[model samples]
Target chain A: MSDTLLRLIRHGQEQGCRPHQRYLLDRAQWATLVAALADMPEVALLGLWGDPGQVHAALLIEDGLLIASCGVPDGRFAAFSPVRPGAVLFERMIRDLWGFVAEGGTDQRPWLDHGRWPVTGPLAANPAPNGMAPPQPVFLPVEGEGVHQIPVGPVHAGIIEPGHFRFHVQGETVVRLEARLGYLHKGQIGLMLGKPAPVAARFAARLSGDSTVAHGWAFAQGVEAALGITPSPRALALRALMAELERLHNHLNDWGFLCNDASFAWLHARAGALREAVLRAANTAFGHRLMMDRVVPGGVSDDLRPGGDAAIRAALAMVAAELPALEAVYDSHASLQDRMVGTGVITPALAMLFAAGGVVGRASGRGFDARRRPGYAPYAPAEAAVLTAGDVDARARIRLAEMHRSVALAKGLLESLPPGELLVPLPQRGGEGLGLVEGFRGECLHWVALDDEGLVRAVFPRDPSWLHWPLLEAAIEGNIVADFPLINKSVNASYSGVDL
Target chain B: MQGWRRLLWPRLAQGLVSAPLTDPPPVPPEEVVQALVARLEAAAQTRLGRSLAIRQVDAGSCNGCELEINAMQNVVHDLERFGLRFVASPRHADVLLVTGPLTRNMREALLRTAECMPEPKWVVAAGDCAVDGGSFKDSYAVEGGIDAALPVDLLIPGCPPTPTQLLEGMLALIEAQRAGG
Candidate 1:
């Protein structure tokens, strides 16, 4: 019944956790919260990560976000994965990173550690030497008559990031699909430690390259919130502008790729052209095609160049003019529709259980956009499309609807652009802050804790892909082997984003 | 009838282009191609004349370089027009466009991919990370760069090089191949 759920834990409120509070909980309190999470459907786990001698969980309860942390001085802690199935991967990662054992945790196989690292528990207080040879990963067993296995990737047959997918199939139908990721684990969070917020932001920006602007903005937002520094109005608007542009280009590319995987190359080519135009506009406006490191802690790094608005407008106009025809073609193509309409159906129950966000969630009848709830500045709450089909077609349709909204949002922000300084000096102080931004894929969450010397003590950047990768496995059930590529493209979960 | 009209409208709306949308090949492929052809003519003594086939590998990038690499296949860059194509398997590839800082998990896979390529192979490290680890340098999980795993013939620099820069890298690889001869 408490809006701040941490109040129910009877723990001391941490100081300087801006916009929201993080409570330090005792063992009993931590156990109670983890136990209660299973019964509470409204509370969603935004992130679960390990800090040296403590573990933290970010939860969304009754429209408010709060963090609950429990100290594990002896390297033992009660596991949430027993009650919350979504916490399983995080539990494994915590074990891999901090050498912490989660008592009664489910599926404790190593997540990020493949046994080839130079050191074990790289983020632990005292890292151990890793000398053992990497062993073959154990996948979940599937037993059925005529059930054979198909193994794919780590090095896929396309120009994309790497992650292995194991599929169990009976003839043509996929019985179970398991994804083994972590090929892109570069120890990003460990590298962020001891660096200032501005320097650490580079890691966040690279957390997921496709959502660079959104991730960069989320990182900047966390730093600003931690230091209690509000960026200038112009800086906020520019950040939003670049974020929407990013959303537009990525959406365009996805729409095309979904079709491309379905054997429709025409739409892919057209969509690719439109995406190129958007990238060119971003380069002209923000100095880089992907706009990496453009959003700094205090504000954006660069102002829009002269005539930047015009370039943005031109790109939007071309997209707007061309989209109707593209949509019509997609809609009218019976062959494409046949492949997409009923394929990769993720039921609303699974969507709700996983707290899936972004297009996938919206397509399956959940309309929780971070931009609208616990909202931030320089913009008003806008409409998010919700369709109930829960199929590949519904996902594609959601992308189309979101693309139109992004173009309009980018234009609106540019027209009302504020004029002022681009950045403010970040103060040297310690604090904790969380940032949740709606990226093209979904809500990207970044939680940061700074030391007294203003260096990063610990941070976790949770890409929406973290929550969706498991769902992809669920979505592939019953679909034929050949349709896996089409279904996978429809979901488009980022491999590198979650691997970190 | 409506479906047919919807599909045909775009083609009717815009006629064939007077010029290709992509910029001209960064360097004339002829001189380099001839050099390669001449060398191959001496070494293998087989009739060899065709476009360059590249196989792209993501060692551990943030996926920015992959996006630009994907864009190179788009209508604007149209990398195929420049006598370069991205094949699915390394066995069919003449060059390897490898990206990322070469994470420990990927180091073995990348080497295996390169080893799968036949003789007369070339490797181009296609981003700053692949060049020398970029921002991901000094991370315990990374080998620092692709060179740690395989011999790199060229390095394309940029956090993630733009498609134009990537195309230039391809051209430069061809020139390097010719110069090696």
Candidate 2:
């Protein structure tokens, strides 16, 4: 594998300017690039971008660098999933969104386009017309004498997002579990095309409501990178504060939910009250409970209100004081331990193959946290708390550990807050740039390519759920159908993030 | 008995609450509640003595509205104390509380869930996305709002409405149903 297979295709370069590199590879070179990516020790991301008559593949390697291979010049290209299993969903998305056929690809089923779209391949230059009968999606069968199939929702029993799961079972034990998603696809990419970075930031904020701060900051970083602007120190500190706050609230909520699933109603109620306090603090400080659209391109939407830091500190102090008692209850409850332990285990090998991130990846011993890896501001010197128990109990414990760390981080950042301007003016100049952030869920990566007029040419926001969801299918294997909810909560993958 | 006490005492002690478990209701202003009450009174006159049963359906939301809905059951709002409860089935529901912009893939599922509800059932659009599609209005995969698929009786607008707003919206819907509107 010669390094020359991936040649940098430059549009232009200037002195003292960051030159964005887009690699060009011949058809013969596609195999070499795929091999190089597969052979690499760690794979960060696999994304696809399409233009009329051609498609490009972007590979983010572990070294905090992106290698985008273009110039395929046709709809047909070699599939990377054959070499790297993590590329399976990305290839399926490319086929559905771009009308590009992943030649020799596994899993050709429709991903986000679930037969109801007006036309197939909406992003293609000339999309296929409506009324072409949608292909019947095949669920890989588990055949046996007594095996039965159980199909669950696009509409579930509880108040949660919609996704379908089909289980092949013999009696109560699940033989196979297949997830059918994209029930929440709102054509997010299509909504962002041609919009200015400022306008597109709103869409990014709502991409996943729970991870709004993380997604919004990533989008802001993307736009800032493209326009060659850096936010002020104060703004960066504020953003980091908000991100940690978001993480704290979400972790508290999940911990409550996990306890509730394990039949611990007391912890659930206490956690809810604490979570509400955090949200109220956020509302008083930032004007929105979820902090949606508060992080915008160039800087934050607003500065902290008077006494906001105290309010946040008070709320965090309450949570920090209360969580240990709840954890004591969780530890002492024999029944809860029985339910969580040794269930839905994912070995490190499987996690790496699926490229799992966040608590799921950490639980399984893959220590790749984007915040630590790419080393962003504020988190550059911080270390991610990694645990490797590889089970449902480990996942829950990881959330607990992260919640404590996030509280401490928020306190430290607020106490030593930087004094400076909160906003910077971004120039209306365009190029390509990448933004990566460690969201509460895992790594959130957003890539933006802007036209000369500063309008977005394309934007791909790859959520950590894209990689984690496939691992859920594998983790549920051999577990009883009754334990599905408990296992599912442990790996709480976002449906909307991946659906988009 | 000694061993049992040793094992359970610590765990039970940890669950104790030193102060009030929840704060005040954080209720909306009197005028807003009065306006809602007036409408509810008119509706209440028609169906004077019935409680409301809600069946929540998430069409395509980002789970923000779902969070608030779940919060209604918490100690603060304690929705059940007001004679309202979330039922497990649409067959028993008096109102269908829906969230999301009605994604195309979920249109059939939403319609089917709505159809499962008994007659005289009301549909309350829970968030801005369910009301008018919000940020996802221009999306190709979404049909804009719940109105595009079902007859939405009321619209509660917020990116994901606050719990107070949702409570008001539900109260209004209950009154609307009581009035036989």
Candidate 3:
């Protein structure tokens, strides 16, 4: 946390391109590095990169975008998870994918490679690092009489993504909840390695279908940063427009699902109708409902069709007009109020510890919006709405408030639309850069390291879900079993985003 | 309270008395019904019935297909109008609408879901990933497509086929069933 350590590790930006810094550390320095990062106020991410023969441990300090990395001689390194609970899952992932040993880590459970994989530690030198079959996952033991465990799905009755949840309950109250994800892991990072930035952008887009535009924008920004290509003003505005539309539609969808969970069918129906309208508008304007693969490294794939702005304006007006009526319905619905209010509370301390992003963080009194922090174009002057109730109602209200702001922002951006080229050609060069975008869910971060031929040597697109998913475990405690659906809908963390 | 009542009554009334919720069918209803009737008559020759029950298995999708599938049940598409419904259990299903490339972790679950269906059931691969693994074909964790694990009867191609496209695929499968091939 010291300025001296930050100066020692921080690499100066040269010629507008951020270079990846490497600090070759002896065993003593490695220990010092881990201790320094763990003492920081917030550790955004801690991960292991498996280069040809060496393993590098990288930690991203939340403030100033300081990334400190140390290369270890072998795969074994001192773990930071003992001091930082947020790094527990990351360390487990490091063990599962890279076969690296997080010495003295808290937990040893496998993260992504769940033994169903043909080979263990696919990113490591040896396919099967342990030279044996993966051990059966041991669920933490729950003591005390009359406590029972209920295991819910990798596949649920509803049409959703796959993830397993095990709840330890006493009578109707949930004592503890453990979530097991990664059923959707498709080796996305491995697939991105060695591919051109444009090609890898597709994998980033599909990381989570609903947040395609956000992830795609983040990936494009990272690639552009690495290549030192500044997108035209028109492209930046268009990207922001698309991001707000994405946020609007996704928030509407979540609101509908939340209403449905609360047994308010009428409001759910209305929300769904409005959401469909938004998607239709997007299709007319951007040529895809979810806008997949529309955002490339240099710029967007296409510009708004002629009069496309009019269609978006019409849709925005309709949504704005209808939202108040829907909000009235939601306010009048007594059953929904009873179910959502004062349920699934996350304390401010927990939110800060987990570095919760987006609505989850804002609702919990942690005002960390990437748009305002990194202050990128089109949103640099904009303010993100934040609230502090830390309950299901707060989460819902946060989304509602955001939807209103996004409508206003979108209209303003469209009215004052910039004129110029949508893309700038990128020179075939290689460097490393970081991109941070305020996605629908929260801040989506992508770090890219490119080779001399402009091929991606290493890429990590960290979804906000990494911070939010673990918080769900803490939020569900002490709540009754019946409130699980409402609580889960409130968080609505992305499984695919984290699984990848 | 008075203000909310003022706003809610008109919208509720409008919703209740609106015209048909969906846009008019792209194809003439009579012609489509005639074709469907013919297919149903031909399908009667086999053990399969005119109505189809579908159970969707998300092998490893990005949830894009699932969202589209959900859209089909909304007021716009109303897939149930075509005598096709998504059931909760595969035991009651006549068609398996599988999405995504089969991930290693989901392969057994997909197979088990398929096996639960009764005889004369067909599998419809609903996305590009289901057909040939799409962009994630070479992933170490994926088995490529549904064809690698289950017998696919029809392939509906798109990153995710639109709701109407999914409905069309279902109707085509009905025709394929009636053709007795």
Strongest candidate by TM-score: 1
Q: How displaced is residue B81 in candidate 2, in Å?
A: 1.9
The window of 10 residues in a row where model 2 chain A has the poorest summed lDDT is A9-18
Kindly list the per-residue Cα lDDT of model 3 for residues A1-500, writing each as its tens digit: 56755655543222233533445555566566667765665655534444434444445455455444544457777876776677788778877777887788888888887788878788766766344565565787889889999998777777788888999999999999999888888888889999999899999999888889999998898898889888888888889999999999999988888988999887777777777878888888888888788888888888997767888999899899999988887898788899988899999888877778899999998878878875688785556677777999889989999999999999999998898787788788888777878988898878788989999987778888888888999999999999998899899999888888
**Cα lDDT tens digits for candidate 1, A134-223:** 989999999989999999988999988899999999999999999999999999998899999999999999988999999999888888
Write down the worst ten-residue block by lDDT for model 1 chain A. Answer: A1-10
| Candidate 2, A263-301: lDDT as tens digits | 888888898888898998898888888888889998888
TM-score, model 1 to reference: 0.95
TM-score of 3: 0.92
Angstrom error of the Cα, residue A408, model 1: value is: 0.3
Docking band of candidate 3 = medium
Interface RMSD of each: 0.6, 0.9, 1.0
lDDT of each: 0.87, 0.80, 0.80
Q: Quick one: best lDDT, which candidate?
A: 1
Colliding pairs, model 2: B43-B178, B43-B179
Candidate 3, residue B106: Cα displacement in angstroms equals: 1.0
* Per-model TM against the reference: 0.95, 0.92, 0.92
Q: In model 1, how large is the Cα lDDT of residue B26? A: 66
Q: Is candidate 1 or candidate 3 better by lDDT?
A: 1
